[model samples]
Structure formats: structure tokens, C-alpha cells
Target: MSLMTTLMLAGGLLLLNGAAAPAETRVDLALVLAVDASFSMEPDEQDLQRHGFAEAFQSPEVHRAIRQGMLGRIAVIYVEWAGAFDQEIIVPWTVIEQPADGPAFAERLLRNPVHRMGYTSISGVIDFGIQQLRHSGLQADRQVIDISGDGANNTGRTVTLARDEALAHDVTINGLPIMLKRPSSLWDIEDLDLYFRDCVIGGPGAFLVPVREKAQFVEAIKAKIIREITDRSNPRSLIQPAHDALPTNCLAGELRRHQPTAR
Candidate 1:
């Protein structure tokens, strides 16, 4: 059977199995947190990236965030991506319906090995998240793609096209921009926040925040996610407003024809 067919059959079984039980299968709020693990993310930085998330789900804030969602539950996936084919789903779809379930899920995430890949294809990673959700089953109140990256679109598909595709289908794209030192290669892009705004974010009430430093990554990730799950009109925490900048890419003119996502 095709993957889609298998997923459908498996979901049917799960529904039947839970039907006789007292409680309903947990609400299916799905969040795809795509982390950038490109060459730019040094090993220690990557460890910090992983640790920040592990710590967040275990935090009181995240637990409270989960409870405040549409049905007091959400399922999440963690993927680390770099290059055109560097996508790896470190954690599969797991439900967090209670306080206890949250921490345990976070522990499983902590054990995954972090591999350093060399190129940064932000759109490649977004595409992977979109595909994962297609097989995720239509059992959720919302679908989200949260991406954290440190650079502009230097490879693979153009960032705007990817954002439009994701947002076109109501899949909100929130961004955590890891802006480090600028290199000659990313000349026109003065700040990653701009790249994320014009190219990486969309959907209902989409937002972007900056992980200004390694230490800030933990808090940034936690705060951003909490607001997302809670449907906060504005992030209760600080977030950088979008900074519009013309695509500084030398070949941007030729790529603009890629078309906005028609999803």
C-alpha cells in the first residue's frame, strides 16, 4: 500500500481502538520544529540547540502552553535539516496530552545524535516538514512548520516560494533566525530577521524571532512555541517584527518567476 493509504488505515485502527475507551484520542495539534544544523551550527551550538528544546518541554511554561491549546494536547516532530538532502527527523510524531507525557517526550528527543552537515537549504527543510505532515493524518486543529535557521536562501529552492506554498494551505511558518556574523556571501542580507520575514514566514499570524546568541536559543525557542500553541494574538514574549529588504541575492531577478505558492 502507498504511504498515504497505510497512514489512513493505521489512523482508522487507532480511532477504533480508542473508541471503546472512556477518553477520546488526544487532540491532534501538530507542530513541526525544523532546526538548522548546517556547517554554520558548530557542534557545541548544535548541542545547545538540542538542549534548549529538551529543557523547554520540561518547563512549566510549555506544559501550561499545551494545556491552553484547543484540546489541551498537541503532537510534535523534530527534524534537523541542512543541504538539499540533509533532512533527518530526529523525533517522530508523539502526543503530549498531559504534564508527565511532556517531559518523557522531551527525554527521547535528548538522545538523538546530532550530525553536522555542510550546506544550508532552508526551503529543502521546509519541504520535508510539509511532506511529513501530509502523512500525519487529518486529525488536528492546526498544522505548523517552525523553522530556525542562521542564513539566507543560498541553495535549493527560493525561500519565498517555499513560504508561500506552506502558508497557502494554512500551515503557518514561524521562524527563529540564528543571526551570527555576516559573511561576504550574504552581503545584501543585513539581518536574517529580514530574510525570514520576506522569504521564510507566512500563514495566519505568522511570526519570527531572533536567537541573538547561543544562550538565548533556549528561551527563544520555548517562548515562541508556547505562544504558537496558545493562539496568542501576539507573542507574550518579545519577537522581532518583520524587516522588509529587497532580496540581495544576485540572481533574485531570474528566480522571482518561481511563483507564489498556489496551494
Candidate 2:
């Protein structure tokens, strides 16, 4: 064979071999980090929330948890949500398989500008998170939606409806109720943690890490992420559990809006 022909055949073989190799990476879990960006959050609060996540992803504890996973890796995506139609994917799906991947994930998180808009639609973001999991491409033993919000669902169809849908699909939903202070508006509920426990989170191993103070945001987020990465079943061990069987008005947000205010 001529020299040129021999080289061409070798190159073609190499290309074919590369194409046949599997490109997908397996992980222990697939997580969607859904942050609430409703108008209730002040600009500084938004920044604090974003930074808290960034710091958590960079923390040694979280990285350690990732490495301890069965596959030693996990796929995560960051999303910001507001009204029923205002869900945005801040960071696309990324796999973290090593310590180095943690900082890279943190960098991407901090580089993006935090957005705030519309009303608080917990149901909308849960639906969006489910969609993301379906299209993540990465195979995982566990699928989770880490939803953090300060208020109740006021604009969406219903939070319970969405939560049930996700649970039915075998996707676990965890909550981070930001109850740093009193309800900002009538639509906001005083028992945000109870709302999360009874209505927002579902599926096996579902739990919440409530942030009751601004100073606790970072530590709370870090602990939550670690627990998630490790697939811990009992989150109450990490944080205080909400009151059991507490009556929560899931439709409180809508009710307040429709009812006439007493003069």
C-alpha cells in the first residue's frame, strides 16, 4: 500500500474507535438545586443565597461526601425559579467526580448573576426540576430535587400536585425553608417549615434544612448539600425536624390573595 493510503486508513480506524467508546459518565445521584428568585427576596438576600450555594459546593465536607458516594460522583444542576413561568436554569448539568470538580462547580455558580422576578411558585420549580432530571442524560441511583424557598406557592396550580407528580416518578424532593424572619406578605406563611414538611417535600428519604437566620445560610446550605450527595435518609439528624402532623394550609397563599382584607 502507498504511504498516504496507510496513514488515511489508520486515521479512519482511530476515529471509529473513539466514536464507539461510551461518552456517558455514571454517578451516584442526580440533583437539581432549585433556588427561589421571587420578588419577596431582597437584592442582598438574593446575593447571599447564591453565594451560600457557591460556598457549599466548594466546601471540603461536600467534596468528601461526593467521594463517598457509591460511584464517587454526582450530577448537579442549578436553577432559579419565580412565578409559574419564570423558571431559569442558571447552571446546566455537571458531573462532580473528584475534589477538583467542586471548585469548578462553585466558580460557575458565583460567575452567574442572580435574578429575582415574579411571584413564589414552588410547584412550578418542582415541575421544572423533574424535567431537568428526565433530560440530565447521566444515570444515577438516586434522583433528587433540592428546592429552597422563603414563601409558599401563590401563583402555580398547586404545590401538592407538583410534589406528588415528582414523588410518583421516583424523584425525591428536599426542602430548605428560608424562615429568617416573619412573612414578608400576606401570601407568605408563618410556618414555612411545616409547609415544606407537609406539602413541599416527598418520596423516600425526603427532608428539609431550614435556614432561620441569615448567618446560618452558608452552614445550612453546606450541610444540606453534603446530606444530599451522601444520600442520607434522615436529615433530622443534621438539623431540627419540624413539628409532626402540624396543620399546614397548602392553599394559604392563594386564599390570602383572593380574600378581601379587613378594613
Candidate 3:
């Protein structure tokens, strides 16, 4: 009854129910775009983030990256997550084979209204991403969860545990750590890049693009998407390395949130 065993049983069931199995779409990648809609992000910041992604998808570069893929297409889903139970799928799995598909995907994405909710559950988002991949009805060369967040996990299970589990299932977890401003809460960990590198991202070719300024958001997302679509091997040069000077406490958020206050 373990997670792995459960997943295996689910896969077996899918195979057994041949008539119920949806036709698997063969693509270069099966990607889950997990965006953060946590309370820490302001309305303006949320707008920026959403527009950045929408613009990236509609760009010529992303289109070219899709065409460069072996199958000339990729399946992607967009999920917005905030609290443990606040995960919502804004876009279901869609195949993008040609340049025209990019705008259509972007249109669908922009049509949805952004929702802001409490808590930052990195673990919840990763777990949700795993579930989406399992039901994606697409046989892809690479399975990736592209998670973008401005804060660390302060709710639900440990982020590292979810990350490790995803890696174990051959799923890569990449990150987009937004460090535009310091969170007002004491729970905010200053070294979010290190936290992401050590606890949030994993598996083959996993890398994070940290957005340090508002102006860089669009470009950062664009670059991240292109690299993901192309399946680049060494992304170290493209992303800033984890700050070795600042030791990352993976449990920093949890500890700060639950710490005993002045009596």
C-alpha cells in the first residue's frame, strides 16, 4: 500500500482496462506547469507572473523549441497551487506541435482568472504534478514538473520528501524561484535559491531560473521553457548555482512557522 506500489497498481489497472485507456499521445515531453498563487504574491506580481508565462508560450522561440523536439510536439498542463488543497488545473493536457498551437495555448491560459490563497505548499504542488503526469495519457520522452514559487513550503508535508518521490518515479522537478522582494513574514527564507536547489528541484537535467527583478520575469520564464522543451543537459551556465556560503535549512519555513512565540 506504499506510494510506489499504489502507482504501480494504477498503471496495471490502466493496462488491464484497454477499452478505457485513452489513446496515448506520443510527444517529446509531458510537462506540468505548477504556478504559485500563494498569499505572499501581490496582485500586481501575480499579473506579472501570468503575463510572463502567457507571453513566453506565444513567443517564436518557444515555438521553435517545440519544433526541434523529436516528436515535434509536447503535452503540457497548467496548475495553480497555493495551499495544501488549493491546487486547481487551469489547463488540461494539450499538444503543441506547430507554431500556431503556442498562441492557442496562451489564449487558454490568459482566459483563466488568477486566484490568491493562503499558505505555500511546495510538497502539495509536487504531489499534484505527479498525479497529473500519471493520468496525462501521453507517452513522452521526458516528464517534467516546472514549479515556480516566491516562497518555501510553510504548509503540508516536507518539500524534499515530495521532490525525492517525484525523482524516484523518473520525473524531473525544475524550479523558478522568484526573489523580487523579501516576504513580510518571518517564515521567509532569504536563501530561497539554495532551498530550491537542495529541496525543490531534482531528477535529470533539473535546473532553476531565479527571477531577481520584475523586468527579468518574462525572459527567465522564456529561457526556462526553451531549455525544458529542448531538453538541455548542462543548465548550470544558464542558471545561478546554489549559494554555498548560505547553508540552506530545508525545514526553515516549517521551523519558523511553528516556533514558540513570546509567552
Candidate 4:
């Protein structure tokens, strides 16, 4: 059976297994926080990223944004990913409607140990995000995959194909390109933000915030979350239309990994 068919069957099974059909909760947004835990991310960077997210939820601004939403709530799941098949859901679907919900979610997120795995797979995470959104069992006004990574897609299916698939489903993808360290190795791309702009993020009002300094992590995460919750365009972010020309190579990560280097 096709993946879509399987998903439909699984959803049906949930209702059939229950005493009564569970009413799907309605929220302003259903968000997947798809984070990178690839080996390329140093231990310090990993900790910083984790704390950044945890703190973002605790911030008053994010809470205020949640309050101002049409339904005054959002459902979110936290996922850490690396390689084609390496994806772990650190925090399961949690609805954040009240002031206490955000902090509770953050605490649960921090309780999990941080881990790093092999390869960088933006495509893998996107595909995973799409599946999770479909199976989340929450009705949302908007669905988004908020991806933050230090590198590009080095494994799995083509990133653009996965991105296009998500766009077809009306799932918006936003990006956070971590550029703290200068690009010296082949694994690193100097124009990662551009790669995200031309390759990764898509759908309505998709944008990216490039993190070049260590100090910006907390603020960046908070700002991005607020913008997403409000579903508004931010002037400070690098907003790109879906049809923009590809200036940076979409296949740069794959090429760097597979093809032989020049003499």
C-alpha cells in the first residue's frame, strides 16, 4: 500500500480502537521543531541550541504571541535528526494553550539527554516532519516545520524534492542556518543561508534567520517562534519567494560527500 494509504488506515485505526471518536483539538498552528544533532554540531553548539529553544518557550514574548493567536494555542513536537533514517522525537505532541503550558513543555524538552549522530539530512527531516504533521491528530490553521541546522543535506533523497512535497501539502518550512564557525571543511558551506533560502524553506511567508554569532541563539529562537505563532512576516528576516532562482547549489551537500575532489 502507498504511504498515504497507510497513514489513512492508521488514523482510522485510532478511531476504531477508541470507545468514542476523539475530537481533534483545534489550534492556531501545528509546529514541528526539526533540529539537527549531526556530528558536525559540536557539543557546545548542541547545548546552546537546546537551551535556546528551552528558553524561547519560557520567554514572555513567545507566550504573548501564543495568546494573541486566533485560537490562542499551538501544538508542537520536538525532533532531533541526523542521516537518512536517524530521527528521534524528543518531545511528543503537546498543546500549549495556557501560560504554564510553554514552560512545562520546555522542562520536558530539557529532561531528555542530548545526542549527536551521523550525517546531515535536511531532506530526511522534512519528510519526517510531513509525516508527523499528517499524523498529529490536531486540526491547525497552519502547519510548519521549523528547521535549524549547522550544515546542509548530505544524505537521503534530494532536499528540493522533499521540500516541494511539503509545499504541495501546504506545509510551510522555515530555516535557521547556524554559521558560528567559519566554513573551512568541505562539509561546511559558506552560503548556507542562501542554500536554505533557495533550497530548503518554502510555502507561504517562509523566511530564515542566519545565526553568525553565539550570542544570538536565544533571541533568534524567540524571534522566530513569535513570528511563526503570529503568522506575520518580519522585516528583519531574509524572506524569499518560493520561485526564487537557485544561486547556491541545491545539491552542494551531496556533491561534497560523494563526488571525488579535484587535485
Candidate 1 stretches with Cα past 4 Å from truth are 1-28, 182-189, 235-263
Give RMSD to native, each candidate: 6.5, 8.4, 6.2, 5.7
Candidate 2: residue pairs that collide: none
State the C-alpha lDDT per candidate. 0.72, 0.80, 0.83, 0.85
Q: What is the lDDT of residue 6 in candidate 4?
A: 60
lDDT of 1 by residue, 83-198 (tens): 87788777666677767877876887888799788667777888888887766643667889999877665568776777788877779898888875554342224566766766
Candidate with the larger lDDT of 1 and 3 = 3
lDDT of 4 by residue, 1-263 (tens): 77854654433222211122244878899899999999999999999999999999988899999999888988888889999988887877778877888898899889999978999899999999988888767788999999999898989999999999999999999999999989988888867888898899999989889898999999999989999999898666464435546478899998889767611
Per lDDT, the best of the predicted structures is: 4
Better of 2 and 4 by TM-score: 4
Which whole-number lDDT from 0 to 100 does residue 181 have in model 3?
86
* Per-model TM values vs. the true structure: 0.80, 0.86, 0.88, 0.88
How many clashing pairs in candidate 1?
A: 0
